[model samples]
Target: MESFSGPDATTSDDGPPPPSPRARSAEARRDAILTAAATAFVEHGYGATSVDDIAERLGVSKPTLYYHVGGKQELLGASFTLALDAYSDAVEDEAVSGVTGRERLHQVVQKYVEITTTVHGRCLHRVPDVELTPEVRDRLRAVKRKVDARIRDLLREGVRDGSLRSADIRMSTFAISGAMNSIAQWYAPSGKLSPEEIAERLWDSFAEGLRPR
Candidate 1:
C-alpha cells in the first residue's frame, strides 16, 4: 500500500495553531466601537445620540458598528453594565475585609469616585433610567437593588461598632449615592483636584459627619 504524498506535503502531529491576529484585531475593534459610542452618548445626551452618530465618530458604517455591538441600544447597555460591574466588584471585595465599617465605607465611596470620572461611569451616573429600554432598565434596577442592600449592611455594621453615629440605612444610601452621582456633574479634567484628591475630600466630608460623638 502507498500513502499519497505531494511534493510540498509533510505529515505533522501539531494540533490547531493559536488564535490568529485577526481574531484579536476584531476584539479590539469592538472595544473601540463601544468606547466611541460612550463618548458620543456623553457629548450629546443619550436621547439625542444615534447609531449613525456613533458610526460617524468611528469613521465606520452603521452596519459595521452593528456587527460589533448589535446597535446603539446594546452599546448603551454595555456601558452601564461595565460601570455597574466595576462598582459591584469593589463592593464585594470590601464586604469581606476585616476593616472597620467606617474604613469599608471609605473604600466603597472611593471606588465610586474613581469610576465616576470615566466616560461609562459618567453615563451611568448622569443618564436617567427612563432613557434605557424596558429590558435593560429592569436588569439595572435589580443590580442596583443588590448593591444598595450591601451598602445598608455596611452602614449597620459601622453603627454597631460605634465607628459611626446612628442613622437610617436607607437615608444613608441615598445621601452617599447622591454625592457620588454628582461627581460627573462638576468634575473636569482641567479642575484643580485629581480624582484621588476629590475622592479623599468627599469621603472626609461624609466621615466627619458620621463620626461618633
Candidate 2:
C-alpha cells in the first residue's frame, strides 16, 4: 500500500489561495459604503452630500470609506452607473420579449417608470452636476446617449409596423424618456396612483395620437 506523505504530495503547485474571510468582509464593507453613499446622494442631492456624510451613514471611518472609494466623485459615478445599468436592463429585457411593436414599446416604458421611481433612479438624476470631473461627465453622457438610442430604436420599429404614428422619433424618444426619468422628482409609492397606473396614463396620453386611427 502506498502511503501519502502529506496533502501537498498530491497537489501541484498553483497560485495563491482564494481571498481570506477578512478580504471578503472588506469587500462587503465597501459595498455597504457605496450603498450608503447612493442613498445619501439620492436623499440629499449631490451638492449637499459629503464623503463624511456617507461615511457616517455607513458607520465607518472616513479613512475606511476612502480605502473603498477614492472619493465622493468616484462614489457618485458608481452610483449613477449602477442606476443606469438597471434602467438599461429593464428596457432591454422588455424589448426582447416577442410581442406587438406597440405592446413592446408600452412594456419598455412601464419598466422604465418602475425603475426610475426606485432608490436607484433618485441617485441617477441627483448625482451628476457641474462639479463632476470631465471623466465623470463623459461617462454620464455616454450612458445617457446609449439609453436614448435604445428608445429611438424601439420607436422607429413601432412606426414601421404602423402601430405608432409618424413623429420625430428623436424628439419623441427624448420626451418619453424625460417623462419617465423624472419620476424620481415627485413619485412615491404612497402617492395617489401606483406605478402601473402612472405608466398606463402616460402610454394612453402619448399613444393616443400615435395609434392608428
Q: lDDT per residue, candidate 2, 163-209, as tens digits?
A: 78746888888788788777778876579998888889988987886
Candidate 1 structure quality by residue, lDDT tens digits, 41-142: 777888899998888888989989877778777898888888878767777853446567887877778877898898888887767878788877887787
Worst 10 residues of 2 by lDDT: 1-10
lDDT for each of the candidates? 0.80, 0.74
TM-score for each model: 0.84, 0.77
- Clashing residue pairs in candidate 2 are none
Relative to the true structure, candidate 1 reaches a TM of 0.84
Candidate 2 Cα outliers beyond 4 Å, as residue runs: 1-27, 93-95, 189-197
Best by lDDT: 1
